[model samples]
Target: MSTLQSQSKIEEANKELVRSFTRTVFVDHRPDRAVEFFDPKGKWHGGNFGTVEGAQNIAGLLTAVVGGLPDIRATEQDIIVKDDTVVVRLVVEGTHKGNLLGFPATNRRVRWDAIDMYKIKNGKIMDDWASEDGVKILADIGAYTPPWMKSGN
Candidate 1:
């Protein structure tokens, strides 16, 4: 095969790997399987939430999220693959059934959009940058009070 074809195949494989990982961890609610798709030293840069290093640490983060939103699921709206990177835009939906970020359970349904980019190496995720709509999630969960809702206003 030509070099271009081989590179395209590699990108396709990477995209598949990311799709499987997203399905297993978010849609399938299987955080325990996350480590299988991550490199031993994989790092996750979660915007606002800060960074989490190591495959186990990343898996732990997912576990905590799942704990808070037991019924959480992500629907992929867009996916882009280039070289060793894969970017996915998703809409995440869930119900707050347990404590999260020090906020008590609200039992409210929440939906937010997110974009995640992953770098693949040797068929495993080496790095991930995640951006989520935190403000919307907080508002949906009744955890945030908008300025207009303040009594002084």
Candidate 2:
């Protein structure tokens, strides 16, 4: 096969890996699959949680998220694959079923959105950056009050 063909195959495999990572981590909540998706020294970033590295840490985090949102589901909006990068847009929904961020379950339904970009190397996800609408989620669940709104109270 030509070099172009080989590159195409690699890109396709990377895209599939990103998709499986999303489904496993956010949809199916498979801890083992989370480990399979990320490289041993993989790095991931989310707001406030700081940087998490290594497959075992990522797997533990995914497992904790599954516990926090037992019915959470990610509705994929778009996917773009180019070179070693794959970006996915998703709308997430779930019920407040367990403790999260030091708050007890409010039993409310919450909808949030996030975009995740993964950097693939040798078919393993090497790095990821995820941006999620955390403030909206916190406000929706009554866990947070906007600064401006707090001044009015």
Which candidate has the highest lDDT of all?
1
Please provide, for model 1 over 75-128, each residue's C-alpha lDDT reduced to its tens digit, 9 standing for 90 to 100: 999999999999999999999998877788999999999999999999999999
Supply candidate 1's per-residue lDDT for 20.
Answer: 96
In model 1, where do residues sit more than 4 Å from their true spots? 148-153
Instruction: For residues 13-74, write the lDDT of model 2, one tens digit per residue.
Output: 99899888888777886766787889999988986667889999988777776677778899
Q: Estimate each model's TM-score.
A: 0.94, 0.90
Q: How good is model 1 by TM-score?
A: 0.94
Taken over the whole model, the C-alpha lDDT of each candidate is 0.93, 0.85
Q: For candidate 1, what is the lDDT?
A: 0.93
Candidate 2 lDDT score relative to the true structure: 0.85
lDDT, model 1, position 145: 74
Clashing pairs in 2: none
State the weakest 10-residue window (summed lDDT) of model 1.
143-152
